[model samples]
Target: MKFLHSADWQLGKPFGRFDPDVRGALTEARFDAIDALGRAAAEHGAQHVIVAGDIFDTEGPEDRTIVQAISRMDRHACSWWLLPGNHDFARNGGLWDRVRQRAGDKIAILSEPEPRELEEQIWLLPAPLIHRHNLEDPTTLFEAMETPGARLRIGIAHGSIRDFGSSGETKNQIAPDRARLSNLDYLALGDWHGTLKVDARTWYSGTPETDRFQRDEPGGALVVEVHPDIAPTVTPIRTGRFQWLNRDWTVNDKAAFDAECDELLAKVDAPNTLLQLSLAGITSLGDRVAMLARLENDLGHRLRHLAVRPDDLVGRPREEDLAALSVEGMLGTAATKLNAKIDAGGPDGVIAKRALERLFVEYSREEQA
Candidate 1:
C-alpha cells in the first residue's frame, strides 16, 4: 500500500517575533505547504495520507483558521487521517467536533487507540493525545493492540522517541524499539521537527513547514510504501516554500567577514529566506561598527528576517580609531578614562565599549555633515 506520512503542521502559529508583514507571510506559508503536500500525494499516487500529530498550532485557533485547514486537506482528494497532538489535544472544547463538521468523510480523526482497518490487508493503530503534557507514554497501548495475521500493522503517534535526547524526550518518551515490541510493519512519529529514522521500522517525517533554525533537516514529508511482509520504503519529499538558516562564522578581519556575508547573500534567495547569524572572534571597533551598519542598512532589507548574535563579538579599538575621533580636552580626558577602564576588564569595561562606540558614531556623523 502506498501512503504519505507527515506531521507537525503547526498551522495558525502567530510568528509574533517578526513584524506584521513577515508574520503574515510565515503563517501563510504553513497553509501553502498543505497544498504542496496534497500535490506530493497525487504525484506519488498515495492511497492514504497520515498526519501523525499537531495538525494545529493550538486548540484555541480561530474558526477561520480551522475552516481554511479543512479546505486545504479536502483538496488532497485522498483519505487523510489526523491524530491529536499535544498542541491540539482532545479537550472538552468543540475544536475536533468543529473540524468533523467541516471535513466530512475525506478527513478522519484518529482520536482513539483502536486498530482501524484502512484497507483489506492494512491496519492502522493510532495513539492520539488527550492532554498537552502526559507523564505516561502515549504509545504504550500499541504494544498490546492486535490485528489480523495477514494485515500490515502500522502505528501512528506523536511524541519523542526514547534514547534520542530530544528536548522533550524526558516528558513524553516513547520506546525507540516500539515497532519491534509491537510487531508492526512501520511506526510514524512526530514532535521532533526533523526528518529522522530511528530504526528499520520507525521514522519521523518532521514538520512540513520549517519553524526554527536548529540545524536539522525540516520541511518534508515521507512517502511510504509497505508490503505484507517486507520493510516499508520511505522517501522524503520537500514541500516548504521558505528557507530557514542558522549560520555560524568566525571573523579575523573585515575583508573576510564581508566576503562571507556576500557569499551567504548570493546563495540564498532573500525574499524567501530567514537567516540567523552568530559571529565570534575579534575585530577593530571601527570594523565592528561598519559591519553592524551594513547589516542594519544593506542586508536587513534583503531578507525576510535577520537576527545576529553579537555577544561573542569583542570590539578592540585601535589607536588610530581613537585619534580619528578628535575630541581633545575635557572630552579627551573622558575618552582616556574609558580607554583605561577597557584595558582593565570589569563592568566598567563593558560601559567603556558602548561609550566608545557612541563617540565614534557621533564623530563619524559630524564628519559626514
Candidate 2:
C-alpha cells in the first residue's frame, strides 16, 4: 500500500517575530500547505494519508481555522486519519467535536491508543495525546498491542524520541526502538519540526511548511510504500512555498561585502522568504555606514523580512576613513580619541566605536540631503 505521512500542521500560529506583511504571508502559508498536501496525495497516488499529530497550533484555535482545515482535507477524497497531538490534544473535546461536525465522515480522528484496520491488509495503532505534556512514553503500549494476522501494523505517535529534542531529560519520550518492539512494519512520528529517521522503521514527518530558518530538514511529507513481506520504504517530498534562510558571513573588505550583498539581493526571486543575516569581521567606518544605508534604502523593503545582527561587526576608522569624514578642530580631536579607544579594545572601546559610526552616519546622511 502507498501512503503519505505528515504532521505538525500547527494552524493559526501567529508569526509575530516578522513584520506585518511577512507575518500574514507565513500564516497563510500554513493553510496553503494544506491545499498542497491534498494535491500531493492525489499526485503521488497515495491510497491513504496519516497526520501523526499536532493538527492545530493550539487546543482552542479559532472556529474559522478548524472549519477551513476540514474544508481543505475534504479535497483529498482519500482515507485520512488525524491523531490528536500535544497542540490539539483531546483535553478539549469541544474542538474535536466541531472538527468532526465540519469534517463529517471524511476525516477520522484518532483520539485513543487503539488498532484501526484501514483495510484487510493494513492496520494502524495510534497513540493520541490527551495532554500537552506527559512524563511517560506515549508509545509504550505499542509494544503490547497486537494486530490481526497477515496485516501491516503501523504505529502513529507524537513526542520526543529518546536521545533527541532534549539534553537527556525530556518529557513525553518515545522509545527509540518502539517499532522493533511493537513488531510493526513502520512507525510514523511527530513533535520534532524536522524530518528525522530513528532506525529503519521509525521516522518523523516534520512540518510541511517552513516556519523557522534553523530547521535544516526540508519541509515536506513522506511517501511510504509497504508490502506484506518487504520493509517499508519512505521518501521525503518538498511542500513548502517559501524558503527560510540563515546566512552568516564575515566581511573583511569593502569589495567582498558589496559583492556578497549583491549576490544575496540577486537571489530574491520571491517576496515570501525569511532571512536572518549575521555579519562579522572588521571594515572601515565609511564602508559600514554605506552598507547600512544600502540595506535600509535598497534591500530591506524588497524582501519579506531581513534581520541583520551586527554585534560582532566592528567599525575601525581608518586614516582614509577619517580623512573622508572631513571634521575639523575639536570634532577631529574627539574622533582621534575615539579611534584610540577602539584600538585599545575594551567595553569602552565598543562604546567609542559605535559613537564614531553614528557620527559618520549622521554626517553622511546630512551630506546626501
Candidate 3:
C-alpha cells in the first residue's frame, strides 16, 4: 500500500510579519499546497493522504478559511485523512465538525484514536490530539489498539520523538522507539516543522510549504510505500511555492562582497526566495557604507524579503571616509568624537559605528549636491 504522509499545513496562518500583499500570497500558497498534495497522490498512484496533524493554524479559523480548505480537498478524488494537531485540537462541535459539514466522504477526520482500514490488509492507526498540549504521549494508546488482519500498520501522530532539553520539546514527548514499541510497519509524525527520520520505520513529514526562516527542508511531503513485512519506502517530494533561506557571510573587501552577492543572486531565483543574510568580519567604513546602500537599494528589491544582520560586521573608518565627513567643521568635530568612541571599544562603540555611517552618508549626499 502506498500513501502520502504530510503534516503542519497550518492553513489560515496570518503571516503578520509580512506586508499585506506578501501575507496574502503566503496564506494562499498554503491552500495551493492541498492541490499539490492531491497532484502528488495522483502521480504516485496513491489513494490516501495522511496528514498527521495541524491542518489549521488555529482551532477556530474563519468560515471562509474553512470553505477554502474543503473546496480544494474536494477537487481531489482520493481520500484525505486529517488528524487533529495542537493548533486545531479535537472537541465537541469544533473546527473539525465545521470541516465535516463541508467535507465530502473523501475527507476523513481522524479526531479519535482508532485503527481504520485503508485497503485490503492495510490499517492506519491515528492518534489525534484532543488538547493544544498533552501531558501524556498521544501514541501510547496505539499499543493496545488492534486491527483484524492488519498486515500494514501505519501509526500517525503529532509530537516530539524525545526531550532534546529544549522548551519546545517539553510537550507531547513520544518515545524514540515508538514504531518498534507499537509493532507498526511505519510511523508518520508531525510538530517538528522539518523533515526528519526517527528510525527505519518512523519519520516526520514536515510542513508542505516553507513558512519560517529556519531552513529545515520545509517544502515537501513524504510519499510512503509499505508491504506486509517490509520497511516502508519514504520519498520526499518538494511542494513549496516560496523558499526561506538563511545564510551567513563575512566581508573583508567591498568588491569581494559585491561578487559574493552577485553569486548568490545568480544561484537563487530571488523573486521566489526569502533570505536573512548575517554579515560579519571587517572592511573600510566607505566600503561598508557602499555595501549597505547596495543591499538596501539594489538587492532588497530583487528578493521577496531581505533581512541583513550587520551587528558583527564592523566598519573601520578610512582617511578618505573621514575626509568626506569634513576635516575642520562641526560635522568633523562630531565625527572625531564618534571615531574616538569607536576606537575606545565598549557598549557605546556599537552606537558610534552607526552614527559614523550615517554621518558619512549625509555628508556624501551634501558633497554631491
Candidate 4:
C-alpha cells in the first residue's frame, strides 16, 4: 500500500511579527503548500493519506482556511486518516468537531484510542490527544493489542518518543519501547517538527511546512510504501514553498563584511525566502551602519523578512575614534565596553548580545542630542 505521511500543517497561522504585507503573503503560502501535498498524493496514486497531527494552529480557524483544507482533501478522493496532535485536541467544541461536521463521511478523525481497519489487509492504530496534555505513554493501549492478522499493521499517533532524548514538559509521550512492542510494521508519528527516525520501524514525519527558524533538519514530509511481507520504504519529500535561512557571517574588515553580505544574499531567491542574518566578529561603527543600510535596501524587497545582528562589530575599537567624537558619558562608555567584549575572542557566545550593545550606543547618542 502506498501512502503519504504528513503532519503539523499549522493552517491559518498569523505571522504577526512580520510586516503586514509579508505576513499576508506567508499565510497564503501555507495554503499553497497544502494544495501541493494533495496533488502529490493523487499523482503518486496513494491509497490513503495519513496526517499525524496539528492540522490547524488554533481551535478556531478562519472560515476560509477551514474551507480550503476540506476542499483540498476532497480533491484526492481517497481515505484521509487524520489524528489530532496537541494543537488540535479533540476536546468538546474544538476545531476537530467543526471539521468532522464539515468533512461528513469522507474524513476519518481518530478521536479515541482504537484500531481502525482501513481495508482487509490494512489496519490503522490511532492514538489521539483527548486532553491538552497526556503525560503517560498513549501507545501503551496498543502494545497489548494482539497483532491483527492483517497484511499491514500501521500505527498513527502524535507525540514525543521518549528514548530519542526529547526533553520537555511534553504530554502524550510515546516511548520507543512501545513502538517495538506493538509489533506494528510501521509507526507514523508527529509533534516533533523535524524529520527523525526512532528505529527502523518508527518514524516522525515532521511538519510538511515549517513555521520557525530551526535549521536543525530539512523540513518536509514522508512518502511511505509498504508491501505485505517486506520492510516499508519511507522517502522524505520536500514540500515547503519558502526557505528559512539562518547564517552567521564574521566581519573582520570592510571588504569581508561586504563579501559576506553578498554571499548571504546569494542564498536567497528573493521574494521567496524568510531570512534571519546574524553578523558577528568585530567591525567599526561606520562599517556596521553601512552594512545594515546596504542589506536593508538591497534585500528588503526580495526577502519576506530580514533580521540584522550588529553587536559583533565592536572588535578592537579605535579609542581615538570615540575620543574625537563630540559625544560623551554613557554613549562613549557603551562603545568602549562593546569594543572590549568583541576583542575578548568570544565570537560564538551570543551574536545578539553585541547587537543589543550597538543598539544602546546608537540610541544613547540620539537621546543626548
Q: Cα lDDT for residue 84, model 4? A: 81
lDDT of each: 0.84, 0.81, 0.88, 0.74
Best by lDDT: 3
**Model 4 bad stretches (over 4 Å):** 144-148, 163-169, 216-218, 315-369
For lDDT, candidate 1 versus 3, the one ahead is: 3
Best by TM-score: 3
Show the colliding residue pairs in model 2. none
Instruction: Write the number of the candidate with greater lDDT, choosing between 3 and 4.
Output: 3
lDDT of 4 by residue, 109-144 (tens): 988778888878688888888766887777888876
Give lDDT for model 4. 0.74
**Segments of candidate 3 deviating more than 4 angstroms:** 164-170, 216-218, 326-330
| Candidate 4 residue pairs in clash (backbone atoms < 3 Å) | 134-172, 271-302, 283-313, 311-354, 311-355
Per-residue lDDT over 1-369 for candidate 2, one digit per residue giving the tens place of the 0 to 100 score: 888999988899988877787888888889989888888888988878899998888888998888888888887767789998888888655567778777767699898788888778578999998888887888888866677674699899998886564422125788888888878889999887778888778898888997777754446989998876678889999888777788888987778888988897787543766678888988888777777677677667777778889778787877866776656566667788888898898899889988998877776677789
Q: What are the TM-scores, per candidate, against the unseen true structure?
A: 0.94, 0.94, 0.95, 0.83
Q: Model 1 misses residue 102 by how many Å?
A: 0.8
CA-RMSD of model 4: 5.2
Q: Model 4 TM-score?
A: 0.83
Residue 117, model 3, lDDT: 88
- Badly placed stretches (over 4 Å) of model 2 are 163-170, 216-218, 265-268, 325-327
Residues 252-324 of candidate 1 have per-residue lDDT tens digits of 6688789988998888778888889888878888788788788889888999989999767777767877677
